[model samples]
Target chain A: MAYLILKDLLLQRNMMLLAFAYVLLFAFAFQSMGDEGQLVAIISMVGYMFVMVGGAWEEKNNSDTLWNSMPAPKWKIVGAKYLAIPVYVAFVTLVYAVVSSAISLLQIPITTAPINVFVAALGTIGVFVAASLYYPVYFAFGYTKSRYWHFILIFGIVALSSMLPNLFPEKPAWIDPLFEKLPKLTGDAMFLVVAICFVALLVAVSFLLSLRFYGRREF
Target chain B: MESILELRNVVKNFTGFKINGISFSLEPGYIMGFIGANGSGKTTTIKLIMNLLHLEMGEIKVFGLDSRQHEQQIKQRIGFVYDDNHFYEELTITQMTKVLAPFYKKWDWNTYNRYIHRFGLPSNKKIKTFSRGMKMKYALAVALSHKAELLIMDEPTSGLDPIVRSEILDILSEVILDERCSVLFSSHITSDLDRIADYVTLIHNGTILFSTSKEELFEKYSLVKGERSLLGENLRPYLVGYRESQFGFEGLVTDKAAVQAMLNGNALLERPTLEDIMLYCTRGRAV
Candidate 1:
């Protein structure tokens, strides 16, 4: 499993350079999202770029034949992709930190997010949730067939994040009740615990689905 | 002795092409040449053995274990080389092996390095930069490093120059010298098989025509050439496939003795090459 993850990383080594460019690009592009929003955007976009590029490499190399022919099991192959999500998020966060420090040292005009444990955790979980949604489809149909779903997920997130406030000028009446109980129902520490559990459950379910889909897939 | 690999009535179907209940087996310590024309289900059958393609029906057993149920166990001892390079071409051989070497139970870096050195492969260069023969040698080096008992190669020699092809054949010959290893080599290049294949299994149109010892296959068929007038109705049954020309006639005959008797010293009967046998069997009629 570690070897498979390493393979993805080696293939994406050049992407590390591209990631720095993305960090600078997203920092400016989402300047209006504020520091926290820019952090999440950078983490999500860069991390997910790693995920999608990994899949693209597999398709380009037609490497299913290689993996399926070897002793590596389908579960490990599918599991590695999910496991690499956090790694990708961590790498993106690292790049963001370095960029942020450079801006502070150089006194650059661009405003970027300061890396903190809470928002980093939030970004990691957000990327995990997105990967959980993408992997089952990827494992089922492989990279080529699952590409449309990838586009939809990306576009759906972008559209919702950018357009939702304008779409609804006023919060729906039902949303207020859920918001009102939120402070009492959860403190920050408790929210973190609940978020961890929720992400764990979602990932567990997603892993099983991906294993099943990948098992049925023919190279 | 248990067969090294066995396919029992294996069947896989696509819209237009299907492997129609094909069955064959390779005994340990021998090379089985799987010969077929292009689009003749050679790669498909190899894929089925590797479980890259799901079986619609029938069973594949490698090392006397069901291929699907004990896939990991079976594959641990099985090394494979496909026609095309499947390793990440963006990485060097060193990086690629670092990724693959952990999957096998008995991987030996010393042996891998030995082969890499022997094959003259550049350790630092990316695989995409290597020529086709170099890429193949890299694949062969990887396949041999794991102490694999069974090596399944699909068209590994297809496009290689004769020198490289001969070099690969030499390595394969050396691998089976221990009598614990076996090879199932699939190719359209009959001459390569003629030099090394102990057993030949000819598949045509997804069905195996024959699987037998190389010596037996040669003894069973004879390439005969004689006067066009020597081709009489009585001699027709003796010819598998024949062509007539302005000067004389040539054909492949199954019964060398009977053909020789009928011709009564008028025709020449020579031992047929594997290529002649494959062409005659598949073509059924010569142009």
Candidate 2:
């Protein structure tokens, strides 16, 4: 598994470097503007791409049917991609913490909470959501073949989802009272539990689906 | 009788087309050639044996273990070299070598280094820059580096230069020197198989045409060339298929003694090469 990750990292070294740069620049921009949410989103997107490309390499698009012919099972193959996501998230989070911490100490409006844990936890949440949405699609169609279109499609999904509350007409007046009180009862706990459940379900389903698709695909 | 790999009544259906009941078994120490035309199931069978694709209906056993039940364990004992080369395009050969070596338990750096020298592959070069032959050499080198008891390859020499192709065949010959190791080589290039294969399994339209010893195929089947009018219905049972052109008729005849006797004092019966046999066997299916 380590070799698989290392091979894929080396395979996409330039893209990885570029992704890091993208996150760094985006983090700098958002942190400088005191916008932590957008910074987390950018870092999350970068990690998602890393796992997506990893999935593509595992499936082997440009090359011949070499990896597909290797004797590993469908679960181990999908498991490799999932394992890489958190590692990439950790790396990106560490980098963001370093740069953003400096900005926070300078009174640049960045939060000064117990830095490592808070940053890692928040970045992991974003990683979880983005991966939950992206992995199922990426596994459905092996990565390189669908990266561009799915990236665009995922953006549309994110945009439409974010706009739903504003776009949809108002719910009943009594419903607002429940919506307001719901946050009081749960707050981040609800979000965390829901996100964890959804991500777990998505990852499991993607793997099962990938295995089925792979069994039917020829070299 | 311990066979390294055995396929029994393997049937895979792809929508309208089908691979029906293709069966063959490779003895422990002999190299078996898998030959077929374009639409034949050479690669598909390899995939099924490798368990890359699910077997629709059949039983496959590898090293006495059920292919589906112990797929990975069987895989660990076998090395596969598919037609296309796949390594990290961005990684230099050095990086690829280091990263891929640890996956197999029997990985040998010394053997890998030897193959690199034997194939004349550069460790510093990125795989993306290597020529087709070079890439193939690297893939073969990796496949051989691990101490695998079985080697299953699909068209290991199809597009390579003759020099490299010959080198791969030589390597396979050496690999088969061990009494425990065997190979299942799938190829369209019958000449390569003819030169190295101990047995031959010919597949056509997803069906096994013949699975017999290479020497037996050459000895039993003879290619007869003569005038169409000179040939008669009496030879129909022996004729696998025939091509009738403006000049005359040519085809494959399985019974060498009968073919020679039938054309006595007339035409001639010559031993058919693997190519000649495959050509005639697949003649009717070309359209």
Please compute the TM-score of chain B alone for each predicted structure, in the order given: 0.98, 0.95
Q: Among these predicted structures, which one has the highest TM-score?
A: 1
The segments of candidate 1 whose C-alpha lies over 4 angstroms from its true place after superposition are A166-168, A176-183
How many clashes show up per model? 0, 0
lDDT of 1 by residue, B147-204 (tens): 9999999999988999999999999999999999999999999999999999999999
- Which ranges of candidate 2 are over 4 A from the true structure? A28-33, A56-65, A97-116, A144-153, A168-219, B244-248, B284-287
Distance from true position, residue B174, model 2, in Å?
1.2
State in Å the error of residue A15, model 1.
0.5
Best by lDDT: 1
Error of 1 at B225 (Å): 1.0
Cα displacement (angstroms), candidate 1, residue B276, comes to: 0.6
- DockQ numbers for every candidate? 0.91, 0.50
Residue B178, model 2: lDDT of 79
